[model samples]
Target: MGSCIICGTPVEGRICDSHQEDVVFEFRGNEASQLTPGRFYSGAVDGYADFGVFVDLAPGVTGLLHRSELDRRLESLDWEPGDTVFVQVKNVRDNGNIDLGWSIRQSERDFRGALVQDADGDHEDDESDESDDAEAEVETPTVRHGSASRDESDESNESNESGKSNESNESGKSNESNESRHQRDEAEPEPSADRERVEIGTLGDRVGEEVRIEGEVVSAQQTGGPTVFEVRDETGVVDAAAFVEAGVRAYPDVDVGSVVRLDGEIELRHNEIQVETEALVSLEGDDADTVQSRLDDALRGRARPDEVTPLADHDAIVSVGTQLQDAAEEIRRAVFESRPIIVRHTTTADGYVAGAAVERAVLPLIREEHAKSDAEYHYFDRRPLEEAVYGMDAATNDVTRMLQDRDRHGEKLPLVLLVGTGATVESSDGLDLLSIYGAKRVVADAAAVDAEIEESTDVLVSPVLADADASDLSTGALVANLAAAVNDDVRSDLRHLPAVSYWEDAPQAYLDAASDAGYDETYVRELREAIALEAYYQSYEDKRELITDLLFDNGVTPDGDGENAGNLASHVSEQFRLKLDAEVETARANLESREADGVDFAVLDTDAYTHRFDFPPTALLLDELHRREREGDTFVTIGVAMDELYLRSTADVDLRAVAEAAREHAPEAGITAVGIREGRIEFLSGRREQVKEAVVEAVAEQLA
Candidate 1:
């Protein structure tokens, strides 16, 4: 038994099974059965197919590397036939069919050791023989186009090799290690004439050709093998790998957001083009300014649309459309810059529908901007808040996650988005936290916002600030407009969301738009109820696929188009009605009648009489209860829990003014208004009885 080269542990081969993936292999066998899974092997592109590509491991042996096994799109690959590449053998079936997977490490020099494999057995590579016939397909040194000619470099290397000690020459060790040579070479800048600068997007076509690339380092990640730098130019981004030692960071001076010029040879790694870096240096002066200007101009042209096209004919929405366009541009810019987005919304139907609509639109844009298929998940996130308040806990959680990501993956700070929330004074502290860390904050709400909120947020798109009627729009309706502006391809899918958002009276234009989009009134209503019910159970989870299915991708339903399957929304809506009816009935049984200041009040002790955590919460139950208790001309329904109470009134209710007046009546109750739109107030539970009565009297007197 030999010792594993990596950890010095005993193994059956030169590399232990645990560390086998770290070692790459050269296959000499002519049969597929001799190939071992989990170890990477050198291969050449035989050809492509509709489903995948065929990689030739040997003269007569080949393996199928399916398109799904790739980290990037199949069409994006620029490899011509007979190009040397690397892939892992995933499986060798009984029928002699071989399956290959992607390998992140493309070059044999990147691994600590390269092993030789054959039908006989596995052994270490013997580089001294240098047999052209036996290993006819051995690696060829990539030629640097404009640098020292191949003849000169070979002569210089041979002279240096001849001067080396006899022991070092026989052992096959170089005079200078690759890392020290790379460090020395990178210390000096080469003349611009030595290499032609190339755009990152064109690197795929220039594989094995040495060139210089200039761009900003967007991300610098360190792996077990190499330090990978993601450089973004105006056209696109490409990974540049630099190696000093195993698990050691290369070019530590080069960091994220730095504009640098990288000199390297292009190679295909895992079907995606990567740069094997020889030298990387930061660019400054006119060159840096030129690159920065080009990137900014390109970003503005590609990320921002000229104008916002409202899906429906609504004057109120149009009046505030420009601001929505600005918010959309910011969101698009974040995606292009490879920044993560945290979309926080309330746990209501309007919040879920709004978040889902924006999510659907943003996801496709992420896929288009990034080469990786799973970039959508890494770039875009939708988090639901338990309440509308974005407090310390939420902001702290966001900070913790962002810091961890930055340290581990060299990612940029995320953009914190508040949809249908973060417009109140309650959200100020959270916004402050995000601002301190330079995280962009956006508030796209339809409710009246505190004056302080507008000044603090990066982008605040609200009817309250736009001088329009806030009552005419629901949060979902307003944010759906924003979602459409983010991605116009998804505009048709969001037409019915506005109609679905309204519980009672929706704007006629939105209703007409939903009808035009083939969603009848009944269907939208059922969908709204279903989202409301589902959104409540998992109040914190994103439930991305489930929401997508309900909104767009659910299979053929009985009431929906095509052959009959089943309508998921209608079945879920049925439960919504049943549960809501039960809660409202229970609330009505404990209702107390009160008459003061010419107002009739229907009050219920929520903590003592109703289910706390179940469906049809205080707000929904009180809404239904107030609609039923129409015994008087002016009626008010109040649900009082241990420390909080909800108010719904037929009369005008100014929550802030009522809160100030209520605090006066109960001086030590410590009462405050949580949500102005919802008429929610919180107080000391020890003084609940006095606080509830005080609020009722204060509100009644304000209207009286």
Candidate 2:
């Protein structure tokens, strides 16, 4: 028996049952069944698949590291064939399939005790160099000088002189390369050979000519014809394709995040610039450092803007300016890194206005950062949510799509930006699901804050979080300032969006800003109505071009001359007014009035009085009705649908306390508080009458 290496407790072998996971084991056994479940195993990357990667603990014995098990993302991994990696053996299936999970300690040096388990016995791994075979794995950022092994700066390290005339040119016999390398080298010289390096940003001018460029390989995708390496330098990024045989990965050593020198002919294919690679070599030591330093400097310089200054003078905005600046930096950095951004917002007028403002700002920056034309569309996405709460159903759908994209197209995990839709206790489960995969989540609540959401999100920008009053702060105004911070080039396009968001009680600062930008109060109202109408129609699609025309297209030209400036807004707004007026008139005829504790309540059974399937949704209809029936100082509107009850009041009404009171009064009503911000409550349809009366009494008791 041997004592546990971790805690010094007596054990059967090197580790106690309690501390078995404390040590990392290098499995030297040939059989997959020999791998103990729940033990960390040192393995080598065998290959990749759509679902996961194949990791071999020993030759001919491999385990599957499913993408779901990864902490970050599968595409984010820079592992190549034969690179040593660490993973925990989760399970051994009956079919001899070994399931592997992500290990926090990837390197052997991170583990406290590194052990080796083989057929003979268990002992400490003397040297972790088993995968240091003659495989061309780019494991480290150090140059290889006439060396075949991944870790070696082997015997007689000098330039080859087998066919040269000078004495310095000739050297002793070295470890020769395999037939594949010999054949590949015969077609093209090594990339380490002396050549003039050029910037990728200048490649557009040097098209149809051969050039050498040094950069980090951001992506390496194996296509049916060739393997395309998206190499990014300090200046810009470009795709360089290397071909071996059909459907085979060329330059298997090069991978994502590898600093390399590549030589190729710049050519235009499908109207996009591509490099037909002749030679590519991984750079190391000083060479890699020079390229990496330049890239880092460029990223910082390009991504970071000056400290944010609020456009309009508002105390709340001034208080949250730091969070706004941080959100802007995160967005710009994601764009620079070529990471996809998914924007989620409610399908309301404020949500659409805010989401569209950010879209306008980011599209221009995407075009400037990436050379490809579709990079703007591919990288920036805007998704509208039916409800303000980002629930488990939405999070599940997002993760599934992200995983599929990573597995199929080798795309990076998206930066999910929740605008005006992720600041509530209801959104915690959704954020937790995203946090599990290390997916970056930014919650731009703008109006309010919740501690539950704040605890889960990576970046949260809410006025209340900064100890500022959000009573007058609209979500649109907050996000417009944030969008301007992201890309100040499109600042002019966002000048009028904030004023258009407010239906009433708009800050005069925003109104004057809109008036100065050529939008009068009437024009702003028309634009708001038009967007609101369109927002509900699709309610899901971004409607990019149409929204842009209404908000930015007319004002785009220098003269800003367009007779049709108000044509679309006037046309769409007419329908918005007609549909809304019709819904209101129908609801007014069936309104039920009740007075309790010196408070007046306007109750409407939305199911009977309102066109359920038509425009001006139940909530919006109730809000409009409440506004017109403000005869009394203490007035409230309670809209009762089949199974849901919505409350809107000029006075403060605590939704949670009201729900509790109703539950106490009508215990079998099964009343539940849906959301505080939404002022929503749910009840059993069978107890709808009881729930409606109890809720009205509860609200009157508080407002009295």
Candidate 3:
């Protein structure tokens, strides 16, 4: 029996079965089957392949280290042929193929002990000879007692041999101990003051050279090999990879948004400049405060515009500049903190255009802020709602997704941005649900805002509340300005989007801005028609990338076919006009024109006259039909449904006033203004005929 080297427990060999894995072994077997599974072995690099590397364990035995087992990218490996490495034996296949897994520690000194595994599946510790010598010494006393003075010269010879064996074992152990200590010392890097501090933007000039940098950590993630910290200084952001112990987290205290001082060498990683951090320390006390202040100052100077610039020369836009600034700041802070931003917009051409503009501006910022290439997709999302109201259904879906992301990925709660939606009283309940979980809400809609909605959201940008004509502005125009405030770089790209939202009669200022940005009138018209057609097909999807291309990309393809931008728009717009014309003709033929309560009324049973499941939606169809029918007459067009009604008027009409009158006139029917800006009303389905009669009379009285 012998004592285990690690735990000092008695065992059959120098180490117990439990401690076998703790010790690394030098394999001396000549066959692959001689190696034990789940044991670490010392090997030398035989060669490399696109899929994996080949490691030689013995003279003629080798194993394949598949690329999937690698901690980092296969190409990042610096190992050369014949270089000593450590790998774990994962399996020995039935066909004698050896599979090797990656090991963090490449040196035998990193393990508790070293052993030699023979071809017979037996382990021999390097110190086993010393233990044998000690046993001989113990028995020598017994021999002396048995034969007091007999064979003293033989005993002396035996004692000398034992002493030499012990000396050899002690010397080997000492060398291993020294090597381990040296490796540990080398792993801990000391910060040097002699290194010059450089901005991240200037790292291109310092590649392959040592550098010192101080910045705020934008994000941090632990990969198998190192903890990658994305630090943003005044100039720009760069990734710093700090590896203390391979596959172990280093600088455990450094977190996202923390101010840190790092010393490292700049190396090109995957063709991008990255700092392989040698020393990383989180600043504390006055140092931390100073670094934070410096970052804040720089962010303010760069992120915030000198003054709020209105997109158009309008009183309402000028008045809402402060609110726009607040919305922009919230978005910028979310990006800095690595919180996901969720945009909720109505499923309309104007709404999609508005959301896509913001998506374009914010995605670039997310990419710049995160080290991972897929960060933009993970951190920013846009969901389209079927209606212009943020109801319980939309709120429930948002909360579910946010909770899932938070639990599964440890993501921060997102910022819920309601673009071209959520400015009505009906959306307050949905906004409140988001607030219960500490999600920030911002509303940017060119709609008549309700007082309750302004209170429910953190920031509300509604020009109608500032006495602006809601009819003169499109939601796309309003949110395009908000997107510009969030990211100034995309401001020019969004110049044409606002004008494209209007089917006709866009504001002169927006048209001029679009022209200045090189989008002619014909281009704007085609883009608008394309978006309108696309919005009707997949009313739920945001179509983020495709819409961005159609709206912003120049009309030139790599093949020079001039079929990139306007090609899709031209084809889709033709379908839109044809389908819409057919629907309008059907609706007009079914229209019942009459005079009710001294008012001209145009009423149509939309459920029977229009294709509810195809082409333009009920709200959009009513809007166009009303605009074309009510040329000079001050009339009200009503698209009546079983349980709801969509209204359009030549003169300004208050749907809420009509809803209140209908409730009184038809006491048994429950009526409410579901979409105020859309001029929509909902009533109990059971009281359909009674509610219709009451609603027509009430609207006529209000118009009168």
Candidate 4:
């Protein structure tokens, strides 16, 4: 069914529009145009071209023309699918398809003159080439030559005859048009002849250089000579050595996926490019490298340090499965000459796969090695990790210092931290809890902890939770909670794993915690205000208890624990605020109505309150104003829920600006402040005061 153009409502007559005609076009090619030209229409471009034009003019009748014919120019001339263009009919080709000619380029002479010059120059060049070839053939082949071997007597006679002819030709030397004849005699420039080509390999006698070698990156470390990359590109492995500019510089930040290109002086001892790396370039594409780098920076313990820096003594990197055990051995050997001892777990297939990538595998190594051994882990519900150390001066500052210290010992570094979504860790010292060492750690809350368990290999388990019901939640939650509980339940016997938790955004809880821990009320308020401001721009309803309960209010839900009763108070407060805002908006709109129409209105008939009530002094003045503004018959337009006073007058009120202001002020208020057109003033849905204020503002701005 056809709908109204602007509002998309069902149309009855001419679609209540101001436009003169509907835009349409002729169909061409594979697509058929459904509308007529010069009318508003909507469709997609089936095909277009490079010369600032599109081909298929009408759906089935394809043509070409400049886009300027459509009265608009493209910002970027590059064409792609989904771009729209407009055009008008130009010419109809003999092949039935319209030839959409475009003269958007100013002056027809400009194009015609340029084409003529090009054609003339080409013709002359072609004629000159032909004459040169003719002259060359006539001068060289037609002259008679005397040969000695044929006959000496005949040769002597021929030479004597030629000498006589040369003397006779001297008599005809001065000819007419000598310059033209000389030009004709010039030889044609011949094309170059073909030559045999030689292969690059034939130029050099190379031994090991001819051998194609590939190796996977085991470790990029310098063992005895220059920086060496131990890669296994698979064709029996190779240690392609890059020396100085080639070796050390090529693989500065080398990782597992780095593909090394080795074409240098090769030694045949091991069947690999064994001379120190001569030239190394990372084979990783820019996009892949960028994404991996960012992810790694966020999760690692330090920002990228020098590839050879002894950041930490090669320690045992915890991993699971045989695949990781092999990887860990490679990693540890590269980091510390010894192979890293692998800590295997009975991991699921998915778990083993998720941790297979180098990105996820390196984080726990950095975290366990970096964090303080005695770092206390607290397990509590509601507060984020950052808030847990909110007021602890020394601890908070230390965490913040480490977070902000991107450079360690003058070298930039990133910290690797494993975290989940919605789990923010803010340092008080202005350091981002997320270090650029690896992936940004965003630990999701208890509800959405499934992602965490599916990601890590060396799953840290809490000794305290050794007796807890791990089966109470999904595998994801079990992992997340176990991590959380281990980090949280720090006591004498359970001090191995650190704890992590925060109270929900009930500013009062933070304040209480601070006060009980010896913080003053003022300090508590400052922190409370900081947290409360997070919700200021949100709508009142968003803060309602009912909404929060259905959404975020459940910081940690108890499985099978039925309805949550804590949301009742928040729900009531939200309702109260919503009602208050509505009432305020209604009162203001009523006052605005009377002010705009030059009337001091008062209610006389309660039932007709939505209407003009009674003909009081204010109502009468409003009528007079309406008479001064409208251009058609004066009457009331009534609907089931609303009433509008419409009138036709011949006077000028010029309240356009006033009405616009009213609409802007109380968008949700039912009363709308309106300007009298022709001369009548009227009010739509809001309170009078708001309408009056808008009208006054509109008038002031107009006059100014």
Candidate 5:
């Protein structure tokens, strides 16, 4: 029998069963079922897939390391095929499928002890065997009456030596003793001369050494084994895990955003630096104020830019600088507080491009702020709205989901960001409901916003209010600039988004920006067409990964004509043209031209002439038709439906003015400008005849 290396208890092996999981093992087993779950093992990288990496645990025994299990992005891993790595056996399914988990310790030296494991059982190291054999060679002596006195001296000396030996076995300290030590450390006052306080950014240099730090608690979460508190100092943020007891809460009084002084030993967990917190105490009164002051000073110096610089030299962009700063600050605050950010954008090419730019900029910051791999999905969501309006329907869905998340998972309510929408009076009801629930709202659009919307949102970015022609800008261009202000690291990646937003004539500034970022006019057109095609197919789902692949991935060959050399835009654009051209041909054949009150008009019964539940909705179809059929005359295309009417004009038609005329002409029709920017108006179905005649007359008068 051998003594347990951890507790000095006699056992069949070197370590007791209770400590089996604490030591790393080298597996000699051939079958997958022989591996022990929750035990670390040495493995080698096999290959990578879109979902995860394949790891070979033993000869002919491979397991999957899913991307969700990784602490960092799968693409960022610098592993090559056959490179040795360490992982934990999370499970071995009945079908012989092995599941691996990430391990912080990639080297054997990081583990406390190493054991050789096999199909039958585990074995002690060679050094333990040698020591056991030597101990067995010692002989025992018999006691006599006269020799009792002399034996007493030897017995006393031996007892003293045994006690000294036990004291030297610090690694085998009992759990009760460790708990007592932690209690004592917690009760002790702040150190005066033992160790100087260090900045979190410099923790890498002081790893494995005890240090003191003063910071604010950003977040506190309990795992099955420890309570991890994310602490942030002026320099950086770090997670300090405290393990007083399994599944027990630590530092019950220290809550989020509270200033505290902590003492801990720096350690690496999951390939990231973390602190093993030995002691933590809340800083109160003057101490708290001092820490807050220091943090605020540092944040002011580094957190945001001094002034908002416009991406392009435009007067409207310059005028909205203050609002842009507010929006950027709000987004940054949400990230720091661990609050989720929900982006609601219209389901159009321009809207998707704008939303995608924000996604790209914010995801990296989310990943950096939180340790969990799924934090990106939890903290950032990009949802597509069917129309450019945040009405009661969309607001209800968002509030319901957020309320559920808050009740079920104890998550904070998310910050709702309306992109390319929610900046008009039509969406005021939705904004008011969100405000009543204390949810913050921000609007980024290129449309003419209502004056009331300015008061409804925390930050509003609308170029039309600043005297710049909204027609010359796209939502993508404005939000792209906002995204740059949110995170400067992604500025270069977003430079091409503005040009992609324009379907026909792009402003020279945006075109120049795209060109500077290496996208020419043809490439820009291809990207626009490809995105438009994809947007139409999955109108509801925000094809985030696929869109990212098409726009950002340079190595992807969508055409498959060359070895990773063909552009994705080239392939998707072909499909876009084929589908769009067919629809255009059908629309042209059914078009009817008429002149009323000396005004030329092209009218189509959209419900009867076009595919209702298919690609190119009424707004997009009319936009495309006007571009093709309008021949410089004062022309308007009225797409009539059962309950609604869509008006598109070659000349600049004031939708609000037309709506006023229609309302006066047919007061009972309830005509309203629902989509003024799109040159669209809605009419009640009950007064279809009255509304249709009024709309036709209104168009003629406006054209005249």
Candidate 6:
């Protein structure tokens, strides 16, 4: 039988060989076990070593107890390197290296002492006997270690005792050296600060310094003080103040659960850390939110150079913003750090108010960008626009009904935009007119444009056309300021188009948007070079000499008369091609570049998150309403689909009142404006403006 390396005893029968490589395994240090791959251990030792000792954790599981694992103390002679050790398995290597650990340094000390006393000098029995009572009399010692700082003497002892080996008269001492390590099992430690209190100095000594101190609240009395309070950190407590405080005044009224930091001097009273007469703040607030704010304030005050350093690892951070400028900055920072950021908008009133203001004020600045683009802009709406269309149901007569009703021939449609009258311009000047019209119309969605374009049939003027390059400069590119100045629809339209500027005389701010686009460099170069040269232009006599010069040199001149339909068609085709090419290039580059390593950048599919909304828990009250309807106990008994009910769940409206209103309005055919999520219905007015108000008021009244 192979000898157990740990206990120096021979093994019997089939040796249990655990074939787990790199897996942590624990066993008694005294067990007879052979060294094998895939097992690690930690334990008490029975001997000392110059290098390290062999610890046999179990049958076929042995690890080295290196001298580097010994504890502090020049006088420590309890354990030897090769003797039986009470250990914990950490990791087992393939090449037979076993990482071991000990819960307490005393274990190793006791084990080493046992081995030293047992070692035989010429007389083997003397070594073996060692007055058996001596082994029985040794008591196991206990110790604790944590992140908290320890006594300087303890560290000094460890450093000094690292040299030297315990010599024995029996067999020559083992070769392994020893080092000290302390480990603790996962368990809540009992509080022991009451037994002995340590005096750690005042703020000056503790500000940048770290010390362990325990204190008791003598009195948590509050005063009508400023919006500042004192709370304790590990080192000490400090006064935490804030800008807002009218609500916090009385201290005795505060709850006992409130824990505050002390700011100034630490007065030792009755052998406990205590402080008095400092600023006080209430930790108690409405809920967790108040606590979180207090804690955040404390953390901000207590932040130190060391704590700020990430502990080698941590979870990623997250930030949120609804404004484009703020979002862009946040995104840029996240990208720089190579950290993933989950963004969400804070649906507070500030965001909506600011968004509405931005929508109204910024679009006007870039009026030229939306000229020709078939893009659509979406402005911030206090309520969903879809709801507004359904709110216009007050009218009774046919004409009024037609105007008020969202449903026309069972087709639930929304409001029609009242576009300004078309301008009359010659075919040559038609370019400017088309540019102006397109700039205004393009930012609107394809659906909105299609609807509006179909209703109007009269043509007051022929189409004015410009070369492809001039087309963008003359009419396209609605700036944020200019777009925001017009109606909400105009703002929505501007969001859909790219900003472009052709003439040097164009708005400087509008040109900035074009320059921001990736293609601006190419456009700028062509315009400058062509404008300086005479050969690029066919005639200076042409009313559009400057336009001709810019276009011909830039290869933007059409194949037919500048006003011809063929020219307009060609220009549109060229613009489409250029846009398509740019989009394709961007896609190809994204696909070709390597994404961040080890990070899966897949977008979370939202199909599952939607299921929660689809299946809401049945409230007893709602069930009662449904039962009443079934029994014909309720009026009108309007029937809504499952999704509508689900959408209404998040709404402020009362379900019972909505049901009652629907029942009452069903006969009169009072309109029910379905939300955007509804597939069959489209409201006429802005959903947010009209429908949301009615639904909220009606539901809230009923619920109340």
List the RMSD of every prediction in angstroms. Answer: 10.6, 15.9, 15.9, 32.2, 12.8, 29.7
Global CA lDDT of candidate 2, please? Answer: 0.75
Give lDDT tens digits, candidate 1, residues 1-704: 87554445667876777557755677999899889888888899999997888999999899999976775546657678999888999999999999999775554433434567888777754541242132224232222331222222121111100001111222355434576546534554443557778887787699889889888888876543345677888777776766543233456567889889888877765465777777778878998998899889989998887889887887778878888988998898888788888999988888998899889789888776654444676678899987777888998999988886675457889988898778888889889999999999989888857767977799999877777877778889989989999999999899888988888789989889988988888888888888988888867778776677688754124322345667788888899999998888887888999988889888999999889888977777787788888565678889899999999888778888888999999999999998775778999999999998899899889889
In Å, residue 440's CA in model 5 sits off its true spot by: 2.9
Summing lDDT over every window of 10 consecutive residues in candidate 6, give the lowest-scoring window: 312-321
Query: What is the lDDT of every predicted structure here?
Result: 0.76, 0.75, 0.73, 0.28, 0.73, 0.26
- Measured with C-alpha atoms, the lDDT of residue 403 in candidate 1 is 84
Q: Return the TM-score for each candidate structure.
A: 0.73, 0.72, 0.69, 0.18, 0.71, 0.17
Comparison by lDDT, 2 against 5, better one: 2
Best-to-worst order by TM-score is 1, 2, 5, 3, 4, 6
lDDT for each residue of candidate 3 in 223-279, tens digit (9 for 90 to 100): 322445677776667777664322223455566667888887777644567777777
In the range 1-704, model 4's lDDT, one tens digit per residue, is 34322122344521223221211221322432322233322223455554445544434444555544432333233445444433445545455554343322221101100100121111112332443354346432211111111122111111000001110122343222445334322321111223221222221233434333322354443211123344442112334433221001123445445543433334432131243333334445663465345434432322222122111111111111222222233332222211122111112111111111222233233233211111011000011121211123423433443333221111112212222222112221222322222312222122222222323322222211223332122222222222222222211111110110111222233234334444345432322222222222221212222222222222222222344434332344354344334433332344222222333222112123333231211222333333333333222211111223222222222344445564677554443322121122355544544544554445444433
User: Which residue runs does candidate 5 get wrong by more than 4 Å?
Assistant: 1-195, 336-338, 366-375, 403-412, 554-565, 663-670, 683-690
- Between prediction 2 and prediction 6, which has the larger lDDT? 2
CA lDDT for candidate 6: 0.26
TM for candidate 5 is 0.71
On TM-score, the leading prediction is 1
Worst 10 residues of 3 by lDDT: 158-167
Which portions of model 6 show Cα errors greater than 4 Å? 1-146, 149-208, 211-259, 262-511, 514-704
Worst window of 10 by summed lDDT in candidate 5: 156-165
How far off is residue 509 in model 3, in Å? 3.0
* lDDT of each residue in 156-271, candidate 2, tens digit only: 11111011111110132222235544554444445746689999989989887888999987666644234556788877777776654322345666777799998878877546
Supply the global lDDT for candidate 1. Answer: 0.76
